[model samples]
Target: MLSPRFQGLKIIVSDSAMRELFKLGKDMHDVLEVLESGYDAPRKRKAGTIERWLDKGKKTVNAIIALDYNETMQEECWVLVHFGKFARNKK
Candidate 1:
């Protein structure tokens, strides 16, 4: 449910991701902050989901957001596909 500051960019949060956000231990507000700030960097087309360290705190949250541009609107479309926390070792 987050929108980009730039009008040219259209970001969408998947329904499944939204439902699982609580597991990330971060509220929507915090996610918006990190995502908005990430806009400063250039986003490229992505398909393969990969976990990247979010530049928010001490590298805690790992999220995968795929990017694809819409030719009709000529705008960048970002979709937050998935996210999760680091797992602790269990013995």
Candidate 2:
């Protein structure tokens, strides 16, 4: 189950990320679900970069997001930069 706290969080997806999702035949709702329920941790890519991992059936999906804490909105905004099936040491 997704937490109620996530209900107010704003989600933003980049154009490239959207294209990747379309190419992978993945749904935005599924990605949002992952963001809402997955375990998240800070990434070394940048100061605000975060990596969210979600287990779907037997596979794990990873979403890289840039988090912004908005004072006016009083909510955390997530900008999805990349997302795909978890690949270990592909680079």
- Best-performing candidate as measured by TM-score: 2
- For 1-91, candidate 1 gives per-residue lDDT tens digits of 4455323446566787776686666655565555544433234434533334445444445455667666766877766676555543345
What lDDT tens digits, residue by residue, belong to model 2 across residues 59-82?
678878787776766878877789
Q: Candidate 2, 17: how far from true, in Å?
A: 0.3
Per-candidate local distance difference test: 0.55, 0.73
C-alpha lDDT of residue 89 in model 2: 46
Give the least accurate 10-residue stretch of model 1, judged by summed lDDT. Answer: 37-46
> What's each prediction's TM-score?
0.50, 0.63
Q: How far out, in Å, is residue 12 in model 2?
A: 1.4
Question: What TM value does model 2 have?
Answer: 0.63
